[model samples]
Target: MHPAALAGATLGRLAHHAVSGLVGAALLRGASKAAPKAKPATRKAVVGGLAGGIVAARWLGSAAEEARLKAGDMLAEARSSLGEEAPPPSAVDIGGHDHDHEH
Candidate 1:
């Protein structure tokens, strides 16, 4: 996979995690106010959920980085097997840019 594509995927995952965390927090906060007797449990749930979100995001980011490194290693091996005379891989625009024509 291309470096740009890997970067795009990582950024997309980070964005997803951020949005989910915010939504989770908001939901928990709202739920907390609905029941006065379970206030302690609500607080615990909110804290746990926020912490879990952080851990999950970090894990996902690390996984993506690992996958990117593995892909690069595989690509390098393939290129070496093909020898230096082989043509380069085609350009891929993972950033959503239009590259049909030269600038």
Candidate 2:
């Protein structure tokens, strides 16, 4: 439940929604060409696609969030079971570089 993780998740969800909406709009625009009356059908299809995309994106985001939370919980349980503490961010090493010394 770190704030950074929460913000990242939020941004990821929004990205998913935006991408899906664009895809839906594109698909609907193509599909509308088959209709007998082009204008009205195109308009309706665009609207419907946008709405459906939003709903689909919401569902996808929710599922992803659930999985993320579950994974985090599992990791926490494993750490607790092993009686190990995670290092603080500043104390952790990255890419084989030691962070123990001041820059």
The CA lDDT at 68 in model 1 is: 88
lDDT of each residue in 10-96, candidate 2, tens digit only? 999999999999999999887676665677877898999999999999999999999987877787678888998744446635677
Q: What's the true lDDT of residue 81 in model 2?
A: 87
- Model 1 Cα lDDT, one tens digit per residue, 18-99: 9999999999888777769887887899999999999999999999999987887788788888784333445544577777
TM-score list, all predictions = 0.49, 0.46
Stretches of candidate 1 off by over 4 Å are 1-34, 85-103
Candidate 2's clash total is: 0
- Separate clash counts for every candidate: 0, 0
Error of 2 at 87 (Å): 8.0
